[model samples]
Target: MAASTSQHALVSAKSLCAGPSFETRTSKVGFVSVRRCCLGARKLGLVCASNSQSSVMEPAQLPLSPQSGSTPKKSSESALILIRHGESLWNEKNLFTGCVDVPLTPKGVDEAIEAGKRICNIPVDVIYTSSLIRAQMTAMLAMMQHRRKKVPIVVHSESEQSHRWSKIYSEETKKQSIPVITAWQLNERMYGELQGLNKQETADRFGKEQVHEWRRSYDIPPPNGESLEMCAERAVAYFKDQIVPQLVAGKHVMIAAHGNSLRSIIMHLDKLTSQEVISLELSTGIPMLYIFKEGKFIRRGSPAGPSEAGVYAYTRSLAQYRQKLDNMFQ
Candidate 1:
């Protein structure tokens, strides 16, 4: 998203919301915590949190520790199950994937299948995926393996839940078309000017320093794409608006998105700095979970480590992208 003062306000206004997006004005409304509201990264246990208030000039607060998953909720606070998409065509080709729409590769399909195997048993309350098909397809396949047909749509009616949960603390069944919800807000980092360029070509033509700046700068956009800060602003806004409510209501959520988009959320939820964020790189099809408890932030999964690179060389083995991956393995 292009930078706007309103985007800044969303973070600093300390607003409250029922949807993932919140409206702001001069009113000093209750604040929501982003970090404390996420699910935990513990082996299999869930993390949950209650709502918290926010004053102006603060990033939203996160939830504290609680145990929960994807069952219909009778209480507040929820959990999260976050996964990146499988290997994309551009990914397999070793290309820069700023905003170019692409699909999962054969390897990508395998990764998504593995992801399904990873969380086949977890009760996913609601599914939030990016508008991109790669993310969406990966999510759909992953869920289809474990979750029942169609994604679960969240019905945020305190009144409705009050009546439905009278007998049991479970989410009442609603007649939603699909359980999955798509929001452009959750799309991958928009690589403005960098789309369709070969990473090696860009590195050679523009030099490594310039490419690094374009890729990692917090405030600088690529030739036509968004800066990390800008992406963070938009992604954060969406998370606050459409998703945080479910987390607060104690929904066990699953977010299947891209590298940079997830990075923005992780940056805020984990209190990562510009330096740390620049160093961070996400792997395909891996699940990175975050836990919240009692309306406060508790750290869960970090960005995945670099494994099998020197040994298995998942990126380098491919013939078309081999040289490029060889040059950039570190």
Candidate 2:
């Protein structure tokens, strides 16, 4: 089962969005109609009402076993994969990208492909990406390398017509496809006036200390840009309102988003303090894994290549899934 042998498919948004009657709200970002399902849930105490208090907890690592089985039980835990988008043209040029749309550089493309290889054997039932070209590209490229061979289809909810027209006729086709939902809430922090400014030059012009405060401080925003706190407000809210339900539904989710937005989500999941999160750094195109079980998130760190025995040793379900992939493709 070479990855190239798997063909991609596009299904209608209506087919994917069919579920319990939840309120669907649509917002306009430029020309794209971002349809957000306002599926609400009670506060899990995962996040505190105040950001000042630290909620960091060292949850015990879930015990791992080598036992491999063909099918996972309904009670089996789900996997959550978080990946920062690959480097973009502005990143290579050392410019402030913020929310400005940019394509991935050639090295970024290679990085995305390599990232895909690292997690190729992992199960990915659904994907969520920021409505930006670089993040979207990274996700599409990564899925192309998945061993499962399910095509990642971007669900377009721009309009009622678009949703109605994109529906898949066959039920079997829906099973072979993964729905990719794009939301502006997952987009990078808006940099305001610094969108295209060179980072080094801005630092020099604004004074190093001031520039450092604007970029690193959790609460302080740039001249007209969003602070990390501002980014977290939307990112974490979207995670709770929209993404969490899918995970609760036993869907293995992969989020392809930008640095600041993802950092905010990580902050919530890990219960990191504002100070602790400020120091966190994420490299482009690297995938981090976490297990969501019993209403708690257990960090599994970054998964290595598919051949790495230790990577699959984290859970029986993962090991079994990997073994199944090996058997199918061998």
Q: What TM-score, computed on C-alpha atoms, does each candidate reach?
A: 0.62, 0.78
Put down candidate 2 lDDT per residue, 4-100, tens digits, no spaces. 1110000122233233221121110001111211111123433213211011100111011111122233476778888888989999999999999
**When superposed on Cα atoms, how far off is each prediction in RMSD?**
16.8, 15.4
Clashing pairs in 2: 12-166, 12-167
Candidate models: Cα lDDT each: 0.57, 0.70
Candidate 1 — worst ten consecutive residues by lDDT sum?
Answer: 53-62
**Model 1 lDDT tens row, 134-228:** 99878877776663333433222235453344322223333222346566777877887678788889999999999989987788888778888
The deviation in Å at residue 321 for candidate 1 is 42
Cα lDDT, model 1, residue 33: 24
- Candidate 1's TM-score reads 0.62
